[model samples]
Target: MHPALIPEKHPMCGKYMEALVQCRKDNRFSRYIGACNDITYDLSLCLVKEKKIARADRQAQWHDQWRKKKEEDEARMLALKEQAAMSKSESPKEVSSEMQQL
Candidate 1:
């Protein structure tokens, strides 16, 4: 058997190596390099890349949500201002003119 296929003193090494080979075959060189350097291949640089991608996705989602909330808040404030202006108007004619200006 290939040295890479051999189990370390434990049964889990075989499974781990198989996964590592697959990672290499998949062109995930960062993971392969990590596996090559680490004894158990459990703490690889691939994980860092994965985490970075996940974090970026989360940040993008948060930014989108924040933008939507900001738009909603602006809309709410505008509505409140309009309502207040209408309420403060001295006459119905003034209210119509103000609404048209808006």
Candidate 2:
């Protein structure tokens, strides 16, 4: 997107970046550059499944989508944990803090 991404959340990006760098170091930069479509396609498929959108329109949208997806997922997980805690006679806050550590 902006040549910056949270690698931990985008495993495909990290994988692609590693391959791109290796290609460049191996004097195959032109090959990777020429395969931009393949890169976008691969990333798009992965990101789409994560409820994110990555396209040529703009980079900020991609970042926003990713951030939104991440927050939604975390909230859903917290809600589930709270529900489980409620059934187990445990504190929601304590369960929530434990979920954060994970």
CA lDDT of each prediction against the hidden true structure: 0.64, 0.66
How much lDDT does candidate 2 score?
Answer: 0.66
Off by over 4 Å in 2: 1-57, 90-102
For model 2, what is the error of residue 54's alpha carbon versus the real structure, in angstroms, after optimal superposition?
Answer: 12
Top model by lDDT, which number? 2
Model 1 root mean square deviation, Cα atoms: 12.2
Clashing pairs in model 1? Answer: none
Q: For model 1, how does the per-residue alpha-carbon lDDT over 12-95 read when each residue is reduced to its tens digit?
A: 345666665666666556654554444334534444454577799999999999999999999999999999887777578887
- The residue-by-residue lDDT of candidate 2 on 1-102, one tens digit each, is 424445577765677655545554665556645645565466556666544443544677778899999999999999999998788776777789899999
Model 2 TM = 0.32
RMSD for all candidates, in order, please.
Answer: 12.2, 19.3
